[model samples]
Every structure is written in structure tokens, then in C-alpha cells.
Target: MTNEELQTLVKTISIDVFKKPFLHQAKHNPRLRTTGGRYMLADHTIEINPLVFKVHGMDELVGVIKHELCHYHLHLEGKGYRHRDEDFRKLLNETSSPRFCKPLAAQNKKSTSFYIYECESCKLKYKRKRRVNVQKYRCGKCAGAISIQINK
Candidate 1:
């Protein structure tokens, strides 16, 4: 959704669920990778990861907004706003907001490069995250000379 839509959604959810107004801005932040949404302590703004709606749909997006609203309302009222705080926990329970969001699908993929080492004699294979020195290291199974295959 566009920034204007996100802002309106946040405002609506804030008033409907929390009985409080969201005066600050709410927008989708492309830079947010791991989190569904975040409440900025300094600016009082709410930033939602765009992938929430694109990947998980509207229900998940509303859950994320509810979670962030808990933080926004509690912080503004000068109550405990951290995740571990009693007031925060109570507010979450009262509002029926999710304590954590489901992980994004794109985040669960393996993207790192790795190396495969094989024994020349025994044909045993091993995987290593970093490069192995084939000239010095021998296979553990047969003490045979090693060969390397790069996997990206």
C-alpha cells in the first residue's frame, strides 16, 4: 500500500482498538528487513516493513499494526513500553495483539556461499561455510587428499 493508505490504516486501527489517536506518521519502510513493524521512540512514528502486506496479507498487517500501537500508546502515556514490561504485556492481552509476528518467507532462505570438500580416495564429502585449504587438510574418514568445490 502507499504511504497515505498506511497512515490511514494506522490511524484507524489506533482509534478503533486502543481508543487513542495516532498523531504521528506511519509509513512502509523499505529498509526494514527482519521486523514486521517498529515504533520509533524518538520520532513517535510507526514504520512497517512492506513485506508484511505483500507476503503475509491483510490479517498479518493488522496484527503488526496492533503490536506497534501497543508500543505507541504505552510510550506516550509514560508507562512501561518495552516488550518485557508488565503494562505492555497487559495492554497486549487486553487488545488481543500478537506478541510476535510470523517470519517472512523470503527471510528463511539460505543465501550464503559455501564450499564442499571431498576426499580423493574415499569419496567422502563435507560442507564448510569458509574455504578449506585442500593442500594441507586431509579427509577425516580416510586421511586422503582433499578436493574443493565452491557452491554459491
Candidate 2:
């Protein structure tokens, strides 16, 4: 959805779920990588990852908006707004909003190649994402020297 639509949805959800108006901006932020949405304490703006709607659909989008609104409303009211706050948790339960968004499908896929290391004495094998210094590290099984093979 466009930023205009997002702003309207956030405003509507704010009033409907929290009985408060969202007086700040709500926009799609393509730069948000690890979070579904973030409520900016500095500007009181709510930024949602566009991928949430595109990948997870409208229900997920609404849930994310509700989560961000929880932070927005609580902070504005001078109540605890952090995720660990009692006020935030209570508000989330009252609104029935999700505590966390589901993982993206793309993020769930692992395409990583691993470096395989083998012990010289025990033949124990290890897998690591990055190259390991075989000379410095020894096998836990037999304290033997290790060798690295090209990533698979």
C-alpha cells in the first residue's frame, strides 16, 4: 500500500483499537530490515516494512500496525512503552495485537555455504560459516590438529 493508505490505516486502527488518535505520520520504510515496524520515539512516527504487507498479506499488516500503535499510544500518554513494560504488555493483551510478526519466507531459507574442518587424529568434523584457523583450534574430542576444506 501507498504511504497515504498506510497513514490512514494507522490512524483508523489507533482510534479503533486504542481509542486514541494517531497524530503522527505513518509510512512504509524499505530500509527497515529486521523489524516489521518501529515507532520512532524521536518523531512519534510509525514506520512499517513494506514487505510485511507484500509478503504476509493484510491481516499481518494490520497486526504490525497495531503493534506499532501500542508503542505510539503508550509513549504519548507518558506510560511505559518499551516491549518489556507492564503497560505495553497490558495494552497488547487488551488490543489482542501480536507481540511479534512472523518471519518472512525469504528469510527462513538458508543458502549459506559452510567450511568443513576435520580433525587429523580423531576424524571429527566441524562446519563453520567462516574459515577457521586450524592451527590455533584443536578438536574437543581428541585435542588433535585440524584441517580446513573448501566450503560446500
Candidate 3:
């Protein structure tokens, strides 16, 4: 979608969900890598990953918009807007917004250079040169089950 479309969607979601208007810009940012979306504290803008709509479709895109709107509305009103803040948490719960944006599929398209391992318990991402034995060797960080990360 175009930037204008994103702005309209963000504004609509802000009003419908939070009962507040989003006065700032909402545009697709090509630079975003891992995160689905981000709210800018400095400019009061919301940068959404374009790959979200292209890859995941509208339902997932709406969820991300809701998540970012929580930050945008709360921060503007001088309430607790940070992810860890009580007000932010309460608003997120109230609006049924996801605690965090879903990981973009674009981010999972890993290259074939190195093998990646993730700890099941701690969710710590690790990259290694050698193949890891998941059964015999546990995670170095949490002593949890180690599994290879397969791109999906």
C-alpha cells in the first residue's frame, strides 16, 4: 500500500480502537529488518514494515497497526507509553492489541552462510559454524533445548 493508505489506516485504527486521532505520519519503512513496526518517540511517526502486508496479509497487518497505535496514543497523552509501563500494558490489554508485533516473514529468510540455533527456553538466538547436537548439548545461556532455526 502507499504511504497515504498507511496513514489513513493508522488514523482509522487509532480512532476506532483507541478513540484517539493519529496526527502523525504512518509510512512504510524499507529499512526495518526484524520488527514488524515501530513508533518513533521523536517524530511521533509510525514506521511499518511493507513486507507485512505483502507477505502476511491484512489481519496480521491490522494487529501490527493496533500495537503501534497503543504506543502512539499513549505517548501523545503523556501516559505511560513505554512497553513496560503500566498504562501501556493496560491499554494494550483493553484494546486487545498484541503485546509485541509478530515477527515478519522477511526476517526469517536467512542466508545459507551460517547455521542458526535458538534456545527453546530463553529464545536466545545464536549463530554457529558447526552443527549442534540438540539431544546431547543444551543451550549455553539457559540450559534449555537447542534447536536449529529453519526458515519458514
Which candidate wins on lDDT?
Answer: 1
Which of candidates 2 and 3 reaches a greater TM-score? 2
Q: Where does model 3 exceed 4 Å of error?
A: 106-152
Alpha-carbon deviation at 98 in model 1, angstroms: 0.7
Candidate 1: segments with Cα more than 4 A from true spot: 108-152
Number of the candidate with higher TM-score, 1 or 3:
1
Which 10-residue window in model 2 sums to the lowest lDDT?
Answer: 103-112
Q: Quick one: ranking by lDDT, best first?
A: 1, 2, 3
Compared with the true structure, all predictions reach lDDT values of 0.92, 0.91, 0.87
Cα deviation of 60, candidate 1, in Å: 0.8
Output the worst ten-in-a-row residue range by lDDT, candidate 3: 103-112
Q: Mind giving the per-residue lDDT tens digits that candidate 2 earns over 12-100?
A: 99888888888999999999887899999999999999999988999999999999999988998899999999999999999999999
Query: CA RMSD for every model?
Result: 3.6, 2.5, 10.4
Clashes of 3: 0
lDDT of 2 at 114: 89
